[model samples]
Target: MIRKLKSGQYRIYSRKVDPKTNKRKNLGTFDTLEAAKRHEQEIQYFKHKG
Candidate 1:
């Protein structure tokens, strides 16, 4: 999932919530939404690469 921060930045998070923290894992933070979306696609590609 992608979320827009108050700082005008974008953050990528895991699809599932972490049981330990009870929150989505922070995947990465990007300066632009486009960059965040691209990174999210890369993550999905790698996740199902095999």
Candidate 2:
């Protein structure tokens, strides 16, 4: 999932909530939504690559 921050930046988060913290893990923060989305896809690809 992608969220817009108060700083006008975009953040990528895990789709599932963490059981330990009860919050989505912060995958990464990006200056632009497009970059965040691209990174999200890369993450997904790597996750399923194996």
Candidate 3:
């Protein structure tokens, strides 16, 4: 998921909460929402690639 921070940047987080931490994993922080979305797609691609 993507969230807009108070600083106005976009933060990319894992959709699922970490069982150990009980919090969403911090995927990355990006200057733009598009960038965050792109990175999320890349993560999905890598996760699914065999």
Residue 20, candidate 3: alpha-carbon lDDT: 100
Prediction-by-prediction clash tally:
0, 0, 0
* Better-scoring candidate (TM-score), 1 or 3: 1
Taken over the whole model, the C-alpha lDDT of each candidate is 0.98, 0.97, 0.94
- Better candidate by TM-score, 1 or 2: 1
Candidate order by TM-score, decreasing, is: 1, 2, 3
* lDDT-based ranking: 1, 2, 3
lDDT string for model 3 (1-50, tens) is 99999999999889999999999999899999899899989999999999
Q: TM-scores of the models, in the given order?
A: 0.97, 0.96, 0.92
lDDT of 2 at 41: 96
- Top candidate by TM-score: 1
Summing lDDT over every window of 10 consecutive residues in candidate 1, give the lowest-scoring window.
17-26
Local error of candidate 2 at residue 8 (angstroms): 0.2
lDDT of 2 by residue, 1-50 (tens): 99999999999999999999999999999999999999999999999997
Per-residue lDDT tens digits for candidate 1, residues 1-50, read: 99999999999999999999999999999999999999999999999999
